[model samples]
Target: MSASKIAIGCMHLLAKLPLPLLRGLGKVVGRVLFVVAGQRRRIALRNFELCFPDVPEVQRKAWAKESFEVFCQTFLDRSWLWFGSEELVRSRVKLVGATHELKGDTPTIVFAPHFYSMDAGGLALPLNTEREFTSIFATNPDPDLDRWFMNGRQRFGNVKMLNRADGVKPIIQCLRKGGLLYLLPDMDYGKNDSVFVPFFAVQDTATIPSLSRFARLGKAKVVALYNRMTPEGYVAELTPAWENFPTDDHVADTARMNRELQAAIMTMVPQYYWVHKRFKTRPDGEPSLYSGK
Candidate 1:
């Protein structure tokens, strides 16, 4: 069998085990990864140092290591999320607030940050409600893996997946038709339609201004959503929709999105995706943060 097939087989096997067992195994695997993945560990440590400079180095290192373990748990949990029984999945997830109120005529923007269990939040909303869903997914380079991942995401309901390369027409149309747009806008995607914004006191972070546009085009309400793991299972929490969003200025709205994202990330410190180079793309003539120069 091919390597990818073998990996898929292992994921299926992991899916068969209980969540607690998977989490335990994930911790051991995560420790090994933290040691072996030198670059990722460095990047994660650096992110912590940049974001929380007030904290001591020892605490930052501890948070980085714990973040690795939580990330691995989420990675291992995806197989079960994809292939496990819906009843089983439903039993494992708890909706903390009114996430099922998709009855309104206005389109909704579900703003999800990069928490470890963010996928759970994505799955929870669609599974619990009958709202037609739409989301933008980054395509994987490997064809087989890409197909598998897409299938997993769309398994629950009528979810329209847009390729990242595809422009905004389809998404805008979907929103105009009162579809829920599940957006994860925390990552740095270079400087195409993005503007430099402040994230966790880091200046010049590239952030997408699409949220403001979508809210305006669709007349949507922006709802903050996040999922975090607890001893019982996962909690998909939703805040009350924002009142005065998508004002005349797109830049201010983009900054507001980042500020809300920062607050959400604070609720689950270690579960955030710190391995990403959030500060890699510096402005004008600034130096690279992760180049280790």
Candidate 2:
């Protein structure tokens, strides 16, 4: 068997384990990775340093360690989240808060950040409501891995996964048809087609202005879904739709998006995706934040 298939089979077997045991395994694995995964550990630390400079070093380190633990725990959670029974998944992942925002076909966009429990949040929507859902994904290099991800994510409800290269026409169409667009536009995708905006303490962070663009193109109301991981499972909370989003100025709209994201990130500091080199793309004549780590 191919390595990816074997790995997937192992995960399926892992699905048979109890949640507590699976979480324990994740904690152990996370601890080991924190010690051995030098590059990733450094990236997480650097991100924390940049985002939480005012916080004490010891506290930041503690949060960093816990972030790693939560990351692993969420990764392992995919085993049950994907292959486990629907009853199990329903019992575990709870969809709450402003859920009425998801009701009716008003063309909605879910501003889902890169929290560790994002996949759980994605599943929560389809599990709770019968609305057609769409989300963009960059295809994995490994075909088997890509297939695994596609199948796992589409396991419940009617979900259409769009390739990032597929452009915005279909995304807008889906939104106009009242389908939910789960967007994670908070990451630094690169300077191309990105606007420099304030993110936390960083002044000129590269952020995709797609949220505002899509909202305007699709005439969609933007709602923020912040997912949190708990011992029981995950809670996907939906905020009320923004009142005056997607103004004429895309840059201003994008900046407001970051400010809202910063507020959400503060609620669960360790649960956010900290290992990514968020400040990798710098403005002209600026040195890389992740250099010489």
Candidate 3:
């Protein structure tokens, strides 16, 4: 079966558990991964070492480990928070703007970082407000566990899943209808399609197509939305940017937009910088943050 089918099924079953139970389960999974999974540990460590070169090696390593642990804990907590107590999820999040919606033939774009609990980020938006949008999602890592999780996302009133195979039509149609659409332009889908952009002054092969394609095709308002972490609740901010999006030169424009994306994401939550491979695919002839004594 297709990925959308599996994700849709697995997550549904997981959600059936009590919220507390899910939280516990997630904690257990995180702890196990931290202790047993060395590859991701290595990735996190390497990424951090590069991102924060000025910090002492020891300090960077320590923060990366702690960040990984936190990442795992948040992963579990988010699922529990989203499925069990919708209010708690909403409580932690504060929405900034509302002028754009999936109302008619005008599409609105929402950019969220894979920084926080992406699952929680998904729910927080639609659940917090009575607004609606068709959010795009990458295929699940585990095909066997797809169904239930995908369904959980769909539980929110607004999100319409845009699978990798057939995202174009639905996305455009949704935007044309004045609906909101979400996508993450961080991961590299293909080098041929990507542009090397400066993320923290380090060039990364980032996703430029999503924004470029949307900007090229749709006349919708392109808004940069980011969720900032705070002591109390998340500060979700919205800022409107160039719409035609400098479609003149695909590579340069894409790179510029990516740099802008990095700036916006950093502003959202400075702590998120502790964990991602934000500068993974750097430009040739440039020394990588991953390199050090």
Candidate 4:
């Protein structure tokens, strides 16, 4: 069997294990990764340093280590979330706060950031409501892994997974028809069609302005869904739709989005996806953040 198939089979077997035991194993694996995954460890540390410069290095390192643990636990959680019994999933993943916003859609866009428990948050929507849901994702290179992700995400309610290459017309159509759009536009997706905005301490962070653009085009109200992983399972909290969003200026709207995201990330610093190169694409003539090692 191919490596991906073997991995999938192992995860399928893992689904039968109790949540506590599976999480314990994930903790062990995360510690090992912290010791051996030098490049990723450095990246996480660098991101912490850039974002939380005022904070002491020792404390920042602690958060980075805990981030690894959370990341691993959330990754292993997919086994049960995707393949386990519905009774188990429904019991664990809790949806809280402003859930009424999801009712009657009225063209809503869910601003889901790259929290460790994001997949859990993704499941929260379809599992709860019967509304038509749509999300855009980049196709994974490995076909087996790609299939795994697509199947896991679409396993719930009426969900349509659109490739990033697929243009915005269909997305807008769904939104206008009172469908939910789960958007994760926080990462650094290169300089193309992105604007330099203030993200925490970083002044010229390369952030895609899609959140603002989509809200404008689709005429949708933006709601933020922040997910956190607890001992029992995950909590997907949906904030009420933002008022006066997507104003005349798209750039200003994007900046406001970052500000809101920053506030949410502060509540659970270690749970955020810090390993990504958030400051990768710099303005004209700026040095690379992760140049050496």
My TM-score estimates for the predictions, one after another, are 0.97, 0.98, 0.73, 0.99
lDDT of 3 by residue, 96-127 (tens): 66434423445567666566645555665676
Shift of residue 172 alpha carbon in model 4, Å: 1.1
lDDT of 4 by residue, 21-49 (tens): 99999999989999999999999999998
Kindly list the per-residue Cα lDDT of model 1 for residues 135-243, writing each as its tens digit: 8998898877888788888888778899878988888888888889999888888878888988886877888888898889888888878889775568988888887
Clashing residue pairs, candidate 1? none
lDDT of each: 0.85, 0.94, 0.60, 0.94
Sliding window of 10 residues with minimal summed lDDT for model 1: 97-106
> What's the C-alpha lDDT at position 148 in model 2?
91
Error of 1 at 199 (Å): 0.8
Native RMSD of candidate 4 (Å): 0.8
Q: Which lDDT tens digits does candidate 2 get at residues 1-293? A: 89999999999999999889999999999999999999999999999899888999999999999999999999999999999999999999999999999889899999999999999998999998899999999999999999999999999999999999989898999999989999999988999999899998899999999999999999999999999999999999999999899899999999999999999999999999999989999999999999877
Q: Scored by Cα lDDT, where does model 1 land?
A: 0.85
By how many angstroms RMSD does model 3 differ from the true structure? 5.0
